[model samples]
Target: MNKSKWLYFWGLLITVAIIVISCHHLPPSKSSVTIKLSGWGGSPVEQKLLKQVLQDFEVKHPNIKVKYEVISDQYMDVIKTRLIGEAAPDVFYLDALEAPFLMSQNVLEPLDNYITPEFDLADFEENLLNSFKYQKHIYGLPKDYSTLALFYNKKAFSKAGLDSPPNTWNELRSYSQQLTGKLNKYGFGESPELARQAYKIKAYGGKIVDKKGNATFASESGLKGLNLVIDQYQKERTSVLKSDVGASSGSDMFGQGKVSMVIEGNWAIPYLQETFPQIDFATAEVPTINNKKGTMVYTVAYVMNKQTKHKQAAWKLISYLTGKEGMEKWTGKGFALPTRKSVAEKLGYDQDNFRSALVAGVDYATPWQVGKYPAAIANNFDNQFISALLGEQPLNQAMLRAENNANQQIKMME
Candidate 1:
């Protein structure tokens, strides 16, 4: 009720009002951002491991959240459609086989500008990293990869009195003949698809596609390499297709003791171990073709959308997922081999008995990308190549037909 007390109360009220107005006018604090990520469906275990990695990312970056989606089938088709509609995710998985087309489409964000020195761009394998590069701009970062290797059953080798895996094309044929009808119905299981045979085409200085994206694998050099496969299957009768053994895949036939040897990728390791635990097997670099070592390498990368509203956050997610720590966790279980040299060395894959051959082949392996239009080339080649393998036509005739048909389709696509 006194004058002095009333004055003090009024001053306190004015100070409180000034502070409230100042706080309201200041810039709002940074808010959390949600980035949408999409990828094709993987195995249950792989899905779980990825979820854990995302959770860790969220914890590390409290301001960012991730929304993940899985396109179960027709993944590339769905992604292309969504990209055209401008409704694609901020980040998505891009297979090296499909990278060329997308990288050239202008719909992908070049990560080169965003990549920092701490990211260690040089840590990636040159071949794998180059798969996602277009015009010297990096469009994506490879997360993992697999190179084909020769897998042979130890028990079957013992039965055939073969001490080790074949070292050359001729040796492989001789080994196949010695093991056929004694260890299993077929000594070697063959996949007649172009993906498995492209390296063979290259071993003899042949190319799968020209610079302009046309099929050209029917040349003399290409056939020279391919004849090795045809001779073993048609003339020697030591090799059999998966269908011949009533198996779904090469690994399946080998696991069931229907075949003694097979050429497959790293994926077969876990499948065989869990599917047929009792089957003892060892892996070796794919036997040399014409005295030149070669195999096919497959890889997938995490790419950013050019229209992303959250570029920084998306880059963070990609870098973390492909970084050394995250890659170690993802590849530690051996589902897929690491693409980074440091990660592979740290994991001891080079010393692993069953995985060493697969690791070693990365240096000389041919990547499984054949220019911008692969489906056309692969489908035509597969159909005609199978026809040849089944004795429906001559090898040269079948390859010529495939090459012509693939070029026509590629023209339409262009």
Candidate 2:
């Protein structure tokens, strides 16, 4: 009775211990994954908002974790370097300006396969979405965008005896004359960057680059539109650069009462409100040129690195962040304007008095992208266009030289 019973009891105890140890060693049914996301740093408020969004994303997708990092400075250069080394984050912000180059480099994952009909690709502003498309493949989804609009100081306009912002380029010029009263205050604030002036070039059928991707903004049509800027600065003497008024940007010039009107983007709204709350200002769609309406639209998109090891989790993160609900949160504070038409309507930004003008320009706005050599084209155009405005050279000659120089630089890069 004692020996057989003891052996049976020991066997049963050992079997139970083996089962417990095996269960402890077995993998769980669901494992958590961590994916890295990166973007250039924004304002502290924006960072806090992004953190909250990420927290919400984690709550919705508990099996996936996000590791967010800020590149802080030289965002694109750092991102490109990381991409070349195959050390980039699974997801990162890619400006439309840089998207053309990256999309052509085959380092980004084409998002077409992941995009389902339910994603509602149609809801994105077509032009904004097209900025991230190359060769019929969608490489990224736009997260936010901003469009140029006429930002006028309401008090300044009232003081000038003007009832409303100008509706045409001619009206703008005439209004400038009336608004320029004090020596310190100019009628219009001008930013002579290529991104700002590209639309003007397009106003008269000018192309920024030829089919070969060489700079070609010095043509007859180009000068026809650019000459308007030159005339306003050199001949009319009504417009002033921010530097002339000791301000950092067009928005600052308007905020400081150095200019009555300035063409700026949605970013200026919060900046003006926060930095110069005492000033009463309003935004209007940029006035028409050559009987055609136009403005510059800037956008940035979320793209996935082709080298990411966790593709499924990374796509989940990307899809959520750029999806309808997430975009609503990102743009709700109006730090940036929403890219999705539905989200914009939901946020009521399309009807916002300050933002509606920006939204209106979307239909006719030219994206601030010029093929894959924007940096070169922009540098040359800005350098020469300012010279033209300053009367250092005629507009035609300056643009011609700029086109030549930009093309030379592009050839070298090739």
Candidate 3:
């Protein structure tokens, strides 16, 4: 048995001991890279859903960590300030309305380099994707989108003896007349904001802004479309604003049975279901105007800060969050609609009873982007539009004044 065998056993034990001690002393695998993500605060349910998504992402990417923060009020202003100071989150939400300005500023990282063929850029709706593109470079990927649809209280419609939602603008007006009560309820709830009425301008071949981004919504064609809104509120008196009806929003007006129909986005779906469960409601595409179907699409994308040190990790987060798998989870509950055609088809939102109308309008819905000076244009239009709606001024006069004022503000900004 002897000295040779004993020496061999001793050497093997020593070798095993050395290997175990070396492994124990070696540094723990590098700590996960923490990437900051920021977005405006949403409803409790929405926040919970997002937390679930982030948790799932962490599980899949063990080497990456997420630090989420909520910018509760004046979200864009806060984001812009942080970005100017080079203190913005690694990834954050950027709305379509603000995309043009941000993309032009060069503060956002171009995502084209990180996009792979497998990412299936073709799968996203071209219209939504185009909103985040500037000079052929993609700056962000839309996380979700919502298109306006006619949400009608079925009970109210039936009581008014209407069989279905209006299919055309004329029918909508007639239906509104029949549904409007002396003072208690309005047939239609109107938002009267530029974002809501931009399509109406285009319906008559009016451009909201010229190629140079100056306001041109006061054109003859634009007045023709806007006049319809003013007439509905003043002439017909069948429509009411949320303020007029003591409601916080058009959705609230409709939900409270103050209005039989309202043009609202998908976000209202969950709200109505939760807050107004007793209301029997359904959705249809916004009624066609001047023989053309139109609606507005609102979307927000996940954008990376150009100054982020962890570019690759940030891209991974963006890809997964906007990708089919993550999107399915995020939009599955119908709080928001998917931007990808593949994901939409998988979720069957296009065929869903409540969401079908919204999905139907995606192809034709005008995106709610008004060039780089949207804030100025929107402010001027809203102020003057309400005047027209209230009969304080003629539609033509109001729009002309708005267009002039908005352009002047734009020049001042420049």
Task: Name the top lDDT candidate.
Answer: 1
**C-alpha TM-scores of all predictions:** 0.95, 0.94, 0.95
Error of 3 at 23 (Å): 2.9
248-353: candidate 1 lDDT, tens digit per residue: 9999999998989999999999999999998999999999988899999999999999999999999999999999998998899899999999999999998999
Candidate 3 lDDT for residue 359: 91
Model 3: which residue pairs collide? none
On the 0 to 100 scale, the lDDT of residue 5 in model 1 is 98
lDDT of each: 0.94, 0.91, 0.93
Q: Which candidate order results from sorting by TM-score in descending order?
A: 3, 1, 2
TM-score of 3: 0.95
Which residue runs does candidate 3 get wrong by more than 4 Å? 1-13, 20-31, 182-184
**RMSD (CA, Å), each prediction:** 2.5, 2.9, 2.4
Count of steric clashes across candidates, in order: 0, 0, 0
Instruction: Report the error of model 1 at residue 114, Å.
Output: 0.7
Clashes of 1: 0
Q: Rank the candidates by lDDT, best first.
A: 1, 3, 2
| Residue 109 displacement in candidate 2 (angstroms) | 0.5
